[model samples]
Target chain A: MTEKAIEISNLKKTYSGGVEALKGISFDVEKGDFIALLGPNGAGKSTTIGIICSLVNKTSGEVRVFGHSIDKELEAAKRCIGLVPQEFNFSQFETCKQIVVTQAGYYGVPRVIANERAEIWLKKLSLWDKRDTPARMLSGGMKRRLMIARALMHEPKMLILDEPTAGVDIEIRRSMWEFLTELNEAGTTVVLTTHYLEEAEQLCRNITIINHGEIVENTSMKDLISRLDMETFVLDVDRVPDSLPDMKEVSFRKRDEATIEIDVPKEFALNQVFHKLSDKNINVLSMRNKSNRLEELFVRLTEKA
Target chain B: MFSKESLIALQSIFIKEVTRYFRIWVQTLLPPAITMSLYFVIFGQLIGSRVGQMGGVSYMEYITPGIIMMSVITNSYSNVVSSFFSAKFQRSIEEMLVSPVPTLYILLGYIFGGVSRGLLTGIIVTLVASQFVDLEVHHWGILFFVVILTSMLFATGGLVNAIFAKKFDDISIVPTFILTPLTYLGGVFYSIQLLPEFWQTVSLANPILYMVNAFRYGFLGFSDIDIVHALILLSVFILSLFSLAYYLLTKGIGIRS
Candidate 1:
């Protein structure tokens, strides 16, 4: 089997009236990897997804899924992938079971097998009890799950979810993360686009950030975080301090009597800060980033673009 | 003519199209039957009673086949137009477009769906019309062929209209402005032979007239035009309309990005 689940080269899309949505972007997703494609609105993330799914035509490019060219072998390429769009696209009047089974049929799954897969996916997604309910009757979170279940009916090797948890509650979002994690563990390659940076940091091993219709960054999550120039952390101390410890490589200040905040540069280790603070007789109970570190980095990179 | 994926995709779309109208039986199936019944009662019973014999048959009997053909055309055309346009409106068309299904199946599925509805409504109208008068079929095969071909022709027209439709109003424009006018002038209520020589020539230009006359001939055992020639023209028209629809869909006239 090819290690590449998806590969795109020089993908370009110039919509009618000369609106350039995707400006010759290219990337790849290795098999079994959980990846995040992050970007702000109008960054061409959905356009890229649309091109891969054959919903949008590319002016000039090559896209392949598991070594099958989308143009020459679209059915074969599409059969290998599933897309959960940002919006609900299934018929509202259809029952949850009907939606999934119909989706399975589109992939040419046998009716009997479609039925079995419908049951299995619905059960796995905790939607079995609502199988007979019309899709419109499902809550926001349940509808998202229904889309996921429908997408998985064919058991494609790769699944792409665009903002899967946008309107979902935190609890349902966490459960979806767990579900996606389990799917990844089962050897499915997952490419997710989400506004929740915490989601990307928690669930994805690799990240690709697009900005202004181009690939701004494509690296492992760890490597991207390591490249951050600085991170601010807050220290919770055991006792109040009249003055904070002086540190040349770090900027420190007492946010409150018993708490202090510090800006730690990439080259300056937390241990060095701790070492210097301990020398000053300040005992730190717990320390954490003042804000979401990844969020800070994402904001900076996107704004810079 | 299709691969396995294409077949499955066609079946899925066909089933969905079938389910949509059936689910709303009162709205989709009931209106045509009721409308045609009123037509049968008024034109076939009350007004048709005083109108006397038309073409050697009673007025009501003369128009029965024409009315049934009209119902089939209106229903089949409306079913695909409304259904396909609704899919576009709700963005559910993306479900199939984004899938591995071939685009031709999407077209066929909706086409068959409209044909089914049109044919079903034709049956209902035929049964309803039979209540007022005994409909003796001079040729059953011709009746079936003409009705099916007419339904398919208009269904293809509806698909074409839908691909160009941007709003709800766009969907209604063709059926109201173009289709209804054509059907009314197609000799549904009266024979075009009764018209003056010049007006008769104008009526001959209407494509619907051949369909109505051909269908009426199937039931009355005679027609104003040659049955064989009319069948060929109808077939050609159906093929041309289908080709245009297929072309528009492939070009992504309205549904693609």
Candidate 2:
């Protein structure tokens, strides 16, 4: 089996005012695994990433990357990991090419090699067209892409992206997701944190949801979605009934004289509800699922927690 | 966890910072030169015509080294303070904090950057001051030693200020309320010999006074206090400030959060 790309165990972090940011959290990422960390606001996602990247000092725990302890062999471990933060943090005066090349130099890449790698990554991210422009002059989406190019210049085996698509438009967000998917497919271990549950659902095979500084769920996406059996279907009918069917496994709401919304568990087949409506002589006009499997799973899990 | 690669990272950051300040030489290097020239014209030329000699040297020549040292101190301290604090404010310092580069390298990188600008501005001011007065250096070795050491000491001081500074205003508070006052009282314009006996004793406690006098002694071959003691005191201050700055950086104080 391939080695574990990252192993974090019993991590705990307490700020100065006794605020517990991470309370004994633990997880592992296998080589080439694409995992999404889903969480709400103030859920310690940033803290976890910060500790792994050695930006924030952990109160207690062990983090290992590529079988090397971060505390003991920080440089060796860090050399293999690249982090793209949520905010724009590059020097305002530096051009996109300069930012990437300088970051490569920090990892000991020779200047010529760094330049080559920077060019390749910038081109891959579609940022080569603006290579000479100062980073501060770039649009928000371009700056985000520039950050990703900079992070990739070192050719790290593992990449951690915190909200890589936040604040981006739909078209740009989709392109970024596609680009990251390609990167992961090319054998890089990817760890992502994002507020968009749909993005996580579409990209990640495995997921860990953090809330209140603790991991509420860590499992395969299939398993998590399967566990949330609730699904909703909105139906348009020819007419409204004076009273709805009293099915224990399903709930229905009348949208208007001709539309109704029904929520039912997966085990209770939709065919049964349709059969009941047919028996009542009500014609079903149209139907659609109100939420995707992943949305249902996320809402159920977070609400219960 | 020092490595060849980490040193390369330090050098990259140092070079970037040096390029940043020098790229805007009109703002970073010109202002000091102009300010020092005003001092030479006002104090050395206008005021010195009536004050005559100080410490057995012409008044213009007596204050030349002190003014140059003052410029070096201010520039060195401000360079790091402003640059580092701006990095903190912009949240770009996280780039270095997250990298494998050690904290010592980051500190040294900033210190070297500050020292470069400080020394460069000092040289320019010195050249400018020479046009106003016939300056003579009695000991080039002492002069060079004092200039470099004093620049380093203040550069380290700037790092400390940057680490503790929480806001943009915090950066100015020290240079204005503390550094400027200590510098003026440190005998940049007049020899400590002219102060009252009690004030002279109190002036001995100010570290900048030693730096100014040591630098002045290098040029004039005379000092109100022992130059050897001044050198030792300045060395101790540099070591202490360096240690404090390094400790704060490694602990991830202010920069990490």
Best-fitting candidate, scored by lDDT: 1
Q: Chain A TM-score per candidate? A: 0.91, 0.92
lDDT of the structure predicted as candidate 1: 0.90
Question: Which residue runs does candidate 1 get wrong by more than 4 Å?
Answer: A237-246, A253-259, A267-285
Q: Per-residue lDDT for B95-149 in model 2, tens only?
A: 7876777778888899999889889999999899979978778899998999899
Best-matching candidate per DockQ:
1
lDDT of 1 by residue, B18-125 (tens): 988999989989988899999999998999999999999999999999999999999999999999888888888888887777667878888899999999999999
Q: What is the C-alpha lDDT profile of model 2 across A1-305, one tens digit per residue?
A: 77999899999999888999999999999999999998888989999999999888899999999998988999889988988999988888888988888888788787789889988999988999999998889999998999899888889999999999999899999999999999999999999999888888899999999988899999988888778767888898999898877687889789899998888987887888988788777889999977567766777778887
Best candidate, TM-score: 1
Per-chain TM-score (chain B), model 2? 0.97
lDDT of each: 0.90, 0.89
**lDDT per residue (tens digit) for residues A161-220 in model 1:** 999999889999999999999999999999999999999999999999999889888999
- Scanning candidate 2 chain A in windows of ten residues, the lowest lDDT window is A291-300
